[model samples]
Target: MIMLSDWHPDIIEFIISKMQNPRILRYLLENTEDEQIKKAAQDKLKFTPLTAQEQDMYQGIINYKQIPGLGGFSDKIIKEAEEKLRTGGTYSVHNSEFLTGANISVCLTSDFMEAVENDEEYSLRFPDVEKYDEEEMKFYNENWHEIGDVREWEQMGYKVRTYRKMRAKELWNLINVCATYSAEPGIFFIDNANDMTNAKAYGQKVVATNPCGE
Candidate 1:
């Protein structure tokens, strides 16, 4: 048996790369602070090809949900998409290209559709402003709205930045851009979806669908 001291970093990393047991790999991923060892364990866990049996086991499983709606878009999100587009050296009229590249399917709600029809403004709230540390406060102060008249939020024991609103024309423009450029971001009436769902009686609301629309 090899002593613990006999196992050098290179030997441990080689062993980790060859390790087939997922539990040991996961334990090393979580418990180890050595960055190289952690990366080796993570790479082994993440990049290893699944066997035919493993693929068959997860064939029909809906493991991920993509929930994108009106409230999901923000300045930070937009900037990230812009940076990604720039770095990728791709030019597109719509940001939905990023979502498509990321394999994210959007399901717009009834409220979003109604807002488009009625020309209602879209509002975004920055929550938990009171909990921000110095660095966070500085970043938000530079990038987001200034804190003002937070009496209502403060009364509720939560301080927040002044809410921002986008005009109805902007929302319509987004839809038109998506339609023209990407032909994506599918719409689903959430109320109708929940009404048809069997889990409503269990006090569970259907918020989003998996990639397979199940």
Candidate 2:
């Protein structure tokens, strides 16, 4: 098999043009002085078609009600947990245990201490739940714009929502659940993770960690 290092410059350019990773495309667009490469990146970013694998992953995330393996908690899950805490109901650890029992450890992050200490609104943007059909996907691709925040999406006529502010009491209750019951949902300092990540230079943020915190 031909090695990737042996690929021609034209072949590599073609591969980069087909890439779906917006971060890499955006980096090339902004950092490269080559007009042709910049145009290619811009075109790619304007209409990123989801690959079969990406479509399946999105479906799995929706179906499982959680991201499989070690990852940051999606805003939907976080909102659910917040609701449970607010209602004096304990959040369920059965899911975490189920994954752990299957040899798949789950870890999640929250700015609990930061929220409590700063008395900040522990708000999170709700995740997109719509399953797009081919036509819908085409429409989305045609209108796709890089949204820096949920508010920008909303401004672009996309439906968006945010979770209510989480208080110290609710966060403490979550901590209590972790302390007394399952230790599967280990606390991850996401802010620190992103701050220290070298990926930041490439316009990427660290969002998850492996089971062993790698």
Candidate 3:
């Protein structure tokens, strides 16, 4: 009998190396011994790799989605990530400029959020009404990542959701040109709260900002 509560990777791996039972691999619950999990992760080793992607690099990939020209690292990115979730598609991201300063703010609306949740193609791209009134819809918007540098208790999507639109590679390139220092876009999703909660009162149409809100 193996304890299933342990999370120790080495211990579990050791046990799996010895055990050949298939049923034991099934029905693995949490709080169980690390050995049990090691057995499971190893049993499915062919699927889920023993490696994990760095969050910052992943965050960079996610941040790219916020950029104006970029298409949120392409919807297929998430698909690929999910498919390779086991293989661990994570790759290191290296770029000093991308993280030099956290500026150029951006925000997301509830409607956009709905799209991302329901529609696979829907982008959390900022959708504004009065802000784009007669203005170009390209990078013609303002930055609206959040109400201020001071925000709390907001219902957030995946942590990456804050940087939802942006992705690692694209952000690296933009950093080369220094979008972080200029527009200083802050990335976040609070549109549903804004429209429903009346945070900024942009009104029904919707509005967006490149690095700052209107």
Any residue pairs clashing in model 1, and if so which?
none
lDDT of 2 by residue, 11-119 (tens): 2233342243455555666665545456655665543345567555555544544556425657676565444334333222112222223212212234445556675
Candidate 2 residues lying further than 4 Å off, grouped into runs, are: 1-97, 102-112, 118-121, 128-159, 163-165
Residue 102 CA error for candidate 1 (Å)?
A: 2.8
Give lDDT tens digits, candidate 3, residues 1-214: 1111111113223223332222233323222333434444345433223243444455555555557754446766744544454335422222323334333333434443454455332222223333443443332334233322112212222111221332222222222222233332234454443554553454432234434432
**TM-score quality measure for candidate 1:** 0.36
Candidate of highest lDDT: 1
Clash pairs detected, candidate 2: none
TM-score of each: 0.36, 0.36, 0.22
Range of the 10 consecutive residues with the lowest summed lDDT in candidate 3? 1-10
- Give the alpha-carbon lDDT of every model: 0.44, 0.44, 0.34
Off by over 4 Å in 3: 1-92, 103-106, 123-187, 196-214
- True lDDT of residue 164, candidate 1: 48
True-structure lDDT of candidate 3: 0.34
